[model samples]
Target: MEKAGLAEFNVKIVESCLVPPCLPSPRATLYLSNLDNQPLVRTDSNVLLVYEVCENVLPDPAKTIREALSKVLVYYYPVAGRLRKKEDGKLQVECTGEGVLFVEAMVDKSLSVLGDLDQLKPSFKQLLFRFPSNTAIEDVHPMVIQVNHFACGGFVVAVSFQHMVCDGRGVGQFLKGLGEMARGHVKPSIEPVWYRELLKPKNIPVHDLELTKEKIESTSDSWIPLIYKESTQMSLTLDFETVKYVKDGIMLECLDNCTTFEIVAALVWQARTRVLEIPHTQNVSIFFAVDVRRSFNPPLPNGYYGNGVVAIGAQAIAHDVINQPLSYLVNMIKKTKMSLTNEYLISIIDTDQFLLDIYSNQANIILSDWRWLGFNEVDFGSGSPVNICPIYWNENGPNISNGFVFVHSPKRKCDAFKVIVWMPPQEFNLLEIEIEAITNKYVVNGSNY
Candidate 1:
């Protein structure tokens, strides 16, 4: 139950069944965005949230959820479908009105048994969320839900979604709506929207190939850390005050304004690239995502839910990133964000179909900011989760390689963010050393610690 001090769970899937959409409708379908089709193969979005016991009982999760979701699916019907690839190998969700995989389970323990819930490491996370089977058909269910109850009356909700169907924000919307139903709402507080076509790439697919290097996906599951063996994943939490100290120090360098993510991401990027001993002269790149929902002139629909974010790159030599002041790194990320334009977004979809390639550059890092995504609002009868997280790797394999970090707040109640990362153990240890020194050197004073 402890080695990295992570407690193991006795998982037993008592019930495994499909929750098909409630209403009957014509077979429907959705053309996924180019952004959706390009990420690696078989990358599914898996999330787990734990809620303490509730005082009320009428809104019993069992009865309330099934009844509510049966209705919620009537409108958000595509989620009940499966993914099908065309002759060109592009993906589209086939809305056959097929049911989504839903499972009920038990853990035979209390929530507190797994202490320090905030820092559930990747190895421990794999135990909660189950990935799709590798031998399953290509056309797979886009969503799966697993509900597990503990001896203390506490429970955890595990949700998984094929990445091609929706992005992080979209996942938030779905779960939040389901929560409203379980809490006795007439329907989803905010109507679900599907204007994904807005993100479709131009017919010709124009991209700046000169700046792009194609990377093929690796079929090997080398990233999985076996039980009783070393782990390939690591998770860390950074409090708000520490984050602010780092941000203020960078701002003092004459940078006008720097957001939290930009500053933190830059620091991690610099730390990983430097401590990992990447060549000082070799170019290091950080891929930062921007939510395009509001980037349009008139703006996308208020409820438009789909893949609305795109990742832009900030590339510079490692020497500059390591030697330059913090402000330099912040500015590098800022420029990348400001450069995002409608035309640029459109051009990149076809940008040599680059989204389909594997990104294997040893010095590259991908950072996704989820602080603003409303994951804290998912309140099913009980209160919100004490700790909630998104899983990057499942039973199949790692969706992304080393150097991918997901940044999100533990909850809106606290300003601190739980930064979950996937990287090589040796490199991450070096990065951790650099992080500790920098935080003491800049985030907080050594005497204060």
Candidate 2:
């Protein structure tokens, strides 16, 4: 097992500039919805899309993407703006049309020499632009992109977007539009919508008087922590057939219809609780983000690229979570997921109590599902990306673990997926053994790895 540290790679910047909308967009202030204004989402998220050289010899990726980004910004103008706190201590976007940061760079090594690009490495951060030292979250750009061209003509489009502006689905929609523009489309297929008022709460509660105030302040810009820890990475792959087989087996004892995410999530939560040796009398929870785009009456508009997902989780005693049958855990997750309705989401937005509970425990495990987020389908003229990966775990706080992200396997495409997790090295080794036990009990049954 290798440590998650910087690799021997260098990226030389060839060009860098701010790209405003190619056409004029409305200049106005957009108030963020209560859901989008969560202090937990006040940070930036990074992603990398690796592409091989196309045979047709298309236009330069950086130029094409830069031009396309400017065009796309005309519709998503809020993304080109800056964020600030209002008189009520809530966040809002000032549509200044100042533009986003774009950079073009050249890497010394070819994509092949980078070993397994699927597993995230700390050095991969170099693929994206580094923020200025001591820059506050509000002071950072809403979006930043770096197109790294390799010696083999392959390239990686590394991007950073503020989580407060977009979730997984929102980012996917934006990238799809960019790809469309690069391919010579005059406009995006689905028009971008920005009716944040539609998602606003009936009555916004004051956070300063609530229990969430402390949690919110901890994430504030001025309270940087002095301690840091080194994290390790691990992954487990489950192919189509094995997943189907496990789902079928679990359904026999669990609900009639269990999703792949539920089954896998259950396995992960149980294995982690067992390996961490958490006290049986204590409680453990698993939190995950669920996209609520279609949960509304008429459904959020086709192109409403905002933070439309809500974080929900299930809690249980450590003993029960680890000792119970796998089907029991699967059913627990399914029930929690099925309980989320439009009314439930609305209540969460209206009150800060729900969010405080979700983050109340530092030992909780957080998961994000990107298997169907549509990142692999984003084509920038050449073709769909060969690999898409989150550069690091940005959502976790100092007390929490690095967490897990479920992504589609680049090599297996539709038939397989990978679960990327981060933890200390010793704990990671025990986690692998626990995961292997689950695979042996459900997927292998005696088959070799």
Candidate 3:
């Protein structure tokens, strides 16, 4: 079912309920680290997983996941608890052993009817459970999950959880736990550890760096409405050969080596800046979330599920970003990544200030590299998800200035890259050309806007 080229499908809710821990869990208050309290993690993050019909399907996928979720919650108990504010204005979880919201639904059509899953559509929002209108974040369930079984025996799992609970790697670990339980395991392979205290700023000296700390403004009061115009979302892909070619090209320019993400992010940041036609002298920033788990001396525990990511930015004048060689921008990102030292990370945590106001910077583009975030490993009894992606809607009236996610190609996930972007329509068009020029090859563009 399709209308005006948007994904259209009727999802009928079969059952909805809250599932608590199958076993008794600790009932206490869990303190959140400063990284968890950052404004970026204050909102709910939603993702959709599409699973194609399999030859040997498990009996009752929804029931299997629901039961597995309960068992998993026993370990990830904090996720089943509600968030609350302490007298000091810091947020913490009051592990009351409540529960997470789960729903079962039936879709009217097969998953294939929605066309290429790589492309995103606003109507994909229908697959998720609607949080109560005007509910405060603290009052809402920490996690929400909806399983939609399609007419063709395929199914889609939509999950929405408070970002403050965990980052991408953390969520991936939690999902793997569910997969383990669904496969008849008594418990998760890796037991969870909540050692947030280890990350708390000790008596270590805090150093101020180029990374700026700014206050985050609410959506309504932010600059989005003042400057935000129409924006669209689309996906593009670069295969293994193309990426290697680009890397070779970069080597010819500079002797420094670059990772695939560093090169692609730099190319995209430059393309976006050129398409925006910003003033030459105006500053432009490329903000990205960096995982600081390895920055610690002993490193966070293997099963530590929390917000371990901190936002950092690379800045340059618009003119330089546009006119400089791709290697120039790549070097900037490389340097920024090199700055993620344990001391720097502690300073950021000690500063007690939010790292970046994402939308406030009009000429900036925020990027996330999800190629190796372990999302591809999330599986249930049937098989691995055919497609997995973050969900973005215009419910808040398009507050994003420019956002991009670098993902694995659905077809060739091992060595290919898929870049998803949301920006003004015209700019997206020019970006395609600029990206082709950067790679010196044609890129496959998704038809869906």
Candidate 4:
């Protein structure tokens, strides 16, 4: 087998020649260039082994469209293995033998812009809905960049990634890197950095333990994982300016110090509670994924990749989040922001025993704000996306619906920050009413509704 040149390889030509039966299997050995070319991340040994697929089809040549996405994948070091604790409390990366586990690319006749922007919104949503069910944390690659031609003589580029691998901001960094590479740049926007050492559990003296034995036992027993039902739906873009004005109005009236995200999220949470009408006293938690690249010790180096994020959550009696004044809701969200500190993040990580304990608990609602996160910059040679949204998933048994809202700043004046909220049909309807009221209020105030 001929070894491909690292760092200076072209993806398109590689894809055409690297067909199956000749190319290395997707399960082939995973190696990092700086670390003895050893595998650092490995799949869970419990799952059934399956081939991973990467679809590649030629799009009408745009100045920037690459033939294959292999170049992008090659840049990131594959997880050779993960360090796990032994019975003696030592960490080790358990390496499993590897070959190309999976790699397959198909060219579909489906045009990227087979429908109008509004129509394309759902089409994109459907693509997200098609995420493979068997996705494991390890199988979920760090990045997947896709570019497809549209029937309208244009093209669309979409990137799907595992949330555990990178946050939305990290995705922006990856896209920027691809853009630089397509432009013939020798180096990425930021040099890639991998410091798994930062994730190592700290050594705590047994005599100085603050956690009680019962607390430790309870924490250990809390690992009982529960499954949840997940679904994804989409709404047309919301009036960004109007929504901002509405949020501002609510903030001013309530005299609260909450951000727009908090206000909007609170409104959605309240509406969801109304629709679900769960007992006001029931414990309800609302969590928003926060990018923590800057929250790490010595702060993650500019291009540090894998999963630089922490979930910032606000839990309270369902009634408080629902019936509380907008100001109060804003304060709750503000307080949540304070929890993004390094101590809190490390504490959470440490207390959870270095991620050994995974939280399978499902929140009634999870709101992801993509508007300010820069999803619009995901240009793959073609123009920006006409619409973008997230897919749904059922984790254990509890019904979990994911909502992603993005802003659409097109070349036109009428271009508003379009919001597409994905939720169960009934929940969406209730949210629609609240959104409409806010928009209507903006119109009454003579603002851009």
Find the candidate with the highest lDDT and give its number.
Answer: 3
**Could you tally the backbone clashes for each prediction?**
3, 0, 0, 32
- The true-versus-predicted C-alpha distance at residue 404 of model 1, in Å, is 4.1
Q: After superposition, how far is residue 75 of candidate 4 from its true place, in Å?
A: 3.8
- List, residue by residue over 245-351, the lDDT tens digit for candidate 2: 67777876665788889888988898888877777877677778888888876688988888888777677788999899889988889887876776666656777
In candidate 1, position 202 carries an lDDT of 56
Give the Cα lDDT of each candidate: 0.67, 0.76, 0.78, 0.45
Estimate, for each residue in 395-448, the C-alpha lDDT of model 4 and write its tens digit.
331123444454453334354654445455555677778656644664576563
Clashes of 1: 3
Question: Candidate 3 vs. truth: CA RMSD?
Answer: 4.4
Ranking by TM-score: 3, 2, 1, 4
**How many clashing pairs does model 4 include?**
32
Candidate 2 positional error at 310, Å: 0.6
**Number of the top TM-score candidate:** 3
Return the TM-score for each candidate structure: 0.86, 0.88, 0.91, 0.66
Ranking by lDDT: 3, 2, 1, 4
Task: Identify the superior model by TM-score, candidate 1 or candidate 4.
Answer: 1
| Pick by lDDT: 2 or 3, better one | 3
Give candidate 3 regions above 4 Å deviation.
1-6, 130-133, 211-229, 394-399, 412-415, 441-449
For candidate 1, give the lDDT: 0.67
lDDT of 1 by residue, 257-336 (tens): 88888878887887776765666766677776678877765677876667777766777777898888767888988988
Q: What lDDT does candidate 3 reach at residue 251?
A: 66
